[model samples]
Target: MATIQANDYLIKVDEPWTEFSKFVQSHHYSKIVILVDENTRKYCYNRVKGQLPFDHQIIEIKSGEDQKSISTCEFVWSQLLNNDCDRKSLVINMGGGVIGDLGGFCAASYMRGIDFIQIPTTLLSQVDASVGGKLGVDLKHFKNMVGVFKNPKMVWIQTEFLDSLPANELRSGYAEVVKHCLIADKKQWEEISKYDDLSQINQWTNIVVDSIKIKNKIVGADPFESGLRKILNFGHTLGHALESQLLETENRLLHGEAVAQGMILESMHSVNHGKLSQIEFEEIKSYIELIFGKLEKQRLDINDLIYISKKDKKNFAGAIKISTIDKIGSCIYDFNISPDEIKSLFSQSNFN
Candidate 1:
């Protein structure tokens, strides 16, 4: 079992989880609400149901990036109200990133705020979304356009949940693992950089814990993203824009998939800034393409992506800001890339 002390709470990765039950029982909470999406309800809920010592009700919602919205929040609030949830109640968010984001947003907003814990099931939520307490839903897929920074009481993770993950979902979540290594841990990156058949790997416990350590350390220093924490957005600016633009399309990208492609694109941009060396830039592009596949740059609209990127939450003073790699495991945050530069990059057809 790996544990990290977060800014306000603890992050525990333990199977046969008993801490969750202990906490709820010890607090004698007025009510307990377990929130799940259809997927989690099927694959996760029953597995952990016996752990809760107290009675609780379940709230199930359809799962997807599209469901993380005001309408969903309204539905969650109506359920909380109908079930008589109050300040002393606890909301257990059980599922992947979308469920964690939406459920946390709802619990944080309901009755001003109520206590909640994150029981993230998917690798995406377990490694990236669940730890930071950065809770929110999308604004028309603009990506976390409306959210608040409210830490959960604790976060519990069980690696067994990943067994049910499809190959694509595993690849999607591994993007964050890749991002964490790219930004902070060179040695870790060196270890997993050439991984081809993801199915053969089973040290997920170590990988997940290590990734969380990198993020939690960054978050520990800059919980509000005022400075250091922004580096965690290494491949996210372009990644989020790409995710948003394709939100309604049949070929929609998962958050991590978009970020994987974004890393290759942004790493090339890094070379132009003179921070990332040419050889390293090629390495970034080559490895990312090997794992995530070659990005079909021709399929995207440069103008539309630029428009969506301009709306990125990371911007300040009207500048299109992003985190750029300085080297293999170092990055610079809030680096402003002008619109012309973005247009010019795609126009140059930088991909191989």
Candidate 2:
């Protein structure tokens, strides 16, 4: 088992087929429940279930970003209650970010919190969503508005499972990997830049492990998202707002895509503030654009940007706290900027 120690939490990574049963045996829970989405149920459930101890209950939810809502949590909570799942019962989140987020939220709330494990199957969940232990659901189309900060007992990452992910999802997840490198590890940035394929499991293990270490180190210092943890939101502020705004559109961007665009725009902001050198800012944009492709500039309604920015969780005292880059592997948070400035940045070319 590969273990990452994040302050009080320990994330255990194991081979999903053989090692999961061993984890269960060691814990010796009274009951085991597996949470999955329709897609995971069809593709990954049997492969995982076949390796589990017998007689475990299974709960399934409808798949997609639309399902990561309070209503889904209600359904999951009902299923857990119907199963008589107590605090001692263990819940296994057996899908990507949505499953891990909603399932962890359910486990954390049920009976005032229960033990739950994350079996993150997608690259995005493995590197970003699953390890951080940030759990929440969407509220009225705003992303992750109603959520909690709760760590899981363990997180099992099986790169073998990436085989079933769609190409777009894989690309979306790789964006986080890039973000990880940009925030703290220049060596990792160089390494990931050399690879174009994300399906290589062997190569991915080290990348995932390194990314987890960077996040764990940061989260260890600020587990409750007090100050330093906010750095992890490097590209998320505008990215999330844009992602939320585009969620209902046919050309909806994935989380990583939104974040990729966020990184570019925020890097530009960093340059504008004189925190980052023009060369450094351009380097960041160049690499992201190389991998993510050119940002597709759209005429976003400035009023909508202000509306979403106002609703951002990071907003305090009626001021928006934005994150900007100082240099490679370094970031600063709580930097305030005006809506006109943001609109000016958005109007510029190459900031998709």
Candidate 3:
């Protein structure tokens, strides 16, 4: 919908490959690698394939949260080596968040680094992960624990790629959109919550752009997550812990699905710790449930979830670091909470 030029990289939205093609022509790369998981390779790859002016290598990995691992990175690295990739080579990440994370990490670590572009194929990557320059694979279920802050050369976002997604995937990405509104844009949040049917409102350009602007502004302000960027993790702290904890189970959650629920509990925490009113928390919780359905946990062990969360990279010393909102559309970061507090979150929830 719009072209946003950051301090270094450019994000092209819905304008197709005009800017991307121009940028590629200027950069004389030794090789080009297009990274995809099976899902995107089958669905999203062919769209961009015809538009690319140069011949490129297609590297496919399995698609899933579980596949976002060091082992996958090794496989990508091996493929890169087999294709004679070098520092001058380029990697085009052409999938959802997992591909963006894994592909970017591979490109960044390949011979100390190479140029890479993000062509985020799913809404999750499009609005959040792809633009942030945060790249890495998960370390043993703890989400994004082994990542780096390295921005891509550019990001190309097209809404058409989202068309291939199933409803659950779109619902997963909508969690971040909801998070964006909850943390930074109350007006948008109010509007989004009023949706009669989230899926029926087909045009997502405005919505995606809005979330991108909110996130990109925050990331630009605090590129390395030194301070302000942690607000972006508002729902992610407890959300990630729950996500990691459920991975061993059959009903493991999609990243955003977990974050959506995380927001529900974190909203409760906000009322307890910050200025968010009970009315506000209740409203937030109700809206989330209306959209994503209710929290359903049969045997979630709070202690194990806390143990997994303790490994979060954002945590400092022994205190669990998180971001909580003072109110809708605003947030504070570097907030620390105790394990007792987290257990209380579970105890207070409907699931417990």
User: In candidate 3, what are the lDDT values of residues 59-168, reduced to their tens digit?
Assistant: 99898888999999999999999999988999999998889989999899999999999999889989988667788888874667798888899888898788889988
Put the candidates in TM-score order, highest first.
1, 2, 3
Better of 1 and 2 by TM-score: 1
Cα lDDT tens digits, model 2, 136-179, are: 88897566788888888878887767778898898899888888
Q: Highest lDDT, which number?
A: 1
Model 1: residues >4 Å from true position, as ranges?
A: 347-352
lDDT of 3: 0.86
Candidates' TM-scores? 0.93, 0.91, 0.91
Q: In model 3, what are the clashing residue pairs, if there are any?
A: 1-13
Q: Which has the greatest TM-score?
A: 1
Name the regions of candidate 3 deviating beyond 4 angstroms. Answer: 140-142
lDDT of 1 by residue, 110-224 (tens): 9999998998888888899866788998897366889998999989999888988888999999999999999999999988886776787786888899999999999888877
lDDT of each: 0.87, 0.81, 0.86
